[model samples]
Target: MKSSRQLSKIVNIFLHIIALVFTYFLLQGGSLIIESLPNRHTQTQLEDYLDKAQLDALDKSLDASNLEAETLSFNQQSVKTELKGLKDVLAIQQQNYKEMLASRYVTEDNQSNRQVEQIRQKIEQGRVAITEVTQKSNQLKQQLLQNQQTRNQIQQEIQDLKGEARKVLRQEQRSNTLKAFLIRLLFVLPLMAIAVFLFKRFRDSSYWPFVYGWGYFSLYAFFIELVPYFPSYGGYVRSIVGIVACFLVGRFLIHKLQDYLEKKREMEQRDEESRRSSLQNNERNLENSFEKIHKGICPSCDRKFVSPDNKYCVYCGLCIKRECQTCNTLQVSFNQFCFECGEPHREVQENEHSEEHAAEPNDGINSSPPTPSGV
Candidate 1:
């Protein structure tokens, strides 16, 4: 068993080196070749979005520059005309009041003077209001310029961020490519290679546990690593591979079920020896079971077995080699033991003794009668 383990280790190492070389040159390079065929949809869409963003940003910046120049100009023509009208009214009213003072009654002259003062104060208030509006308009123009600069800065920052994001995404993709390659080398390739090795060259080897376990792991790792890198076509390799795998598995199960049913139907018609060989109930089946030898099938349960040392069947826990009770020699069947000495195992010896006893009865009376006749 130790020697068998050593052999399994050797095979595992040899196969691993082959697998590593195969994955590095074959699978990794193949993936790169597949990548070169065409850009995926997401990548194309991303590039389109970036191009659109640049064009849009350029157009908006040009529009903002034009608007920024226009925002500083405030029309003061209307305010100046109104102020001039107020000034003419005030000057004309003062000349009328002076003419009235020269040729009117005393009370009328006093009233005219008060009216002139009121008109002058109203004209001054109108001038102050116009001045306040001009100051507020100037302040608003400055704020607009600041806002325009802010918008432009924001647009530039957005473009910069997008560029940075694209760079990061490219870096991430390169890192992931290498990561997937390494994962295949460390996980997928070795499992697949060992599985192929066991299924081909080491089918009957004693390290069945590794063979069976590694086979399952190979299939599992293939999927875990494969689904992430599915190609661009809709439902392409993934769907096709899934359908094929399911079909093969379903066909295999159907055949196995049919074979089992046929064997069962024939079991009723078979003779005792035939039934014993076909059935698992008899002890002789420990060696003489006539089922097919699969990759790592158990003799008792007829299932896939994972026995590393081949001493015990993994499915049914049946001992592959029974120890001889008489001489402790290891053998397969209960029918034979210790071929060197021809000694039966304890269980077989009991049966033999019982058969011998049953063939003859106690003969004490017959023994005495025979002795007398001889005399």
Candidate 2:
């Protein structure tokens, strides 16, 4: 279980790392595509085309001048009067050609110059455009680079976040697992120890509750891991259910153990009480036997063991009572009172004199029965 848990944690870390790497590459690939867009080459091609156009215009201008020079160089003037009209016609034609050439050349030059100027302007505009494009591209590149750097930083931060989150999660999981383990150990180990103690002390089966509690707590551990998969309210429901389940199971086991212990204690109490009662009964029986051996007459109870030869209880006092032998009803031997009857010696003497006098009078007149002995 320990190894599997460790492996699972390692695997989770690996997966997070892979996810971060994948995200980084995706961002980089997008930046590269943006940087490689086709606008720069297109602008360069337009500049090249304008250069060719300017060159073609200059060539056409040179070709027109060569044709005009050839036409002028072929003119010959002679034959004075006859040649005059030919010369005038040739001159007119030549002038017309010169005018045509000049007009054409001027038109061509003007057009070429205008075209060259336009091309120059275009070139200038193109340069500015290229500079703007370059600036924009550079800015974009810089932005992309910065974005990449930021992405890298963010990726690092994300990695750190994931690491921290995973660490915290793992730590929490470990804590929970450790707590579960400790709870199980606390529940099971102590019960097992108790079972062993009971077996040693009372020699009975008492480990069943521990087994049941272990099974229940193990199930609780598994159920806790499932809490995140459920809906929001499901956690509360599961928590309540778990609490109730734990409570029921714990209560049941504890109640059973308590009941078992109570029964055992009751049995012990009953055994102790019965043993005490038996001892008391034996003592009572022994006392009865001794009474029987003495012919149902304990002199101590009958006040018949008062003798000068005994000092403590011989039958009960195991000694002689120091009293007058004539007074068999136990008399006081010390001071003025009888120890057995709580009567003063002077009162007993007075009663005896009164009895003697009453008995003498009774002799003269239907004497009252002799007063009961010891009155």
Task: List ranges where model 2 is wrong by over 4 Å.
Answer: 1-111, 197-375
After the best TM-score superposition of candidate 1, give how far the Cα of residue 363 lies from its true spot, in angstroms. Answer: 31
- Per-prediction TM-score, please? 0.39, 0.26
For residues 8-119, write the lDDT of model 2, one tens digit per residue.
5586566546545544554355346433432211222222323345445545554554454344333211113333444455455445544555565667765555545554
Q: On residues 1-375, what C-alpha lDDT tens digit does candidate 1 reach at each position?
A: 122356766976766565455544554555564454332332422354355666567767767765664654433344445556655665676666566656556566676776666756665675666567666656666676776787677667667757876886776555555455554546556667878888777654665544555565566556645445554245676689689989999998999999986765555444433332344344335334523233455444556556534645544444444455566565543334567568765435544665789767543432211111112
Model 1 misplacement above 4 A: 1-106, 110-125, 128-190, 196-205, 216-220, 223-238, 262-272, 277-375
Query: What is the model-wide C-alpha lDDT for candidate 2?
Result: 0.43
- Model 1: ten consecutive residues of lowest lDDT: 366-375
Error of 1 at 184 (Å): 2.4
Question: lDDT values of the candidates?
Answer: 0.55, 0.43
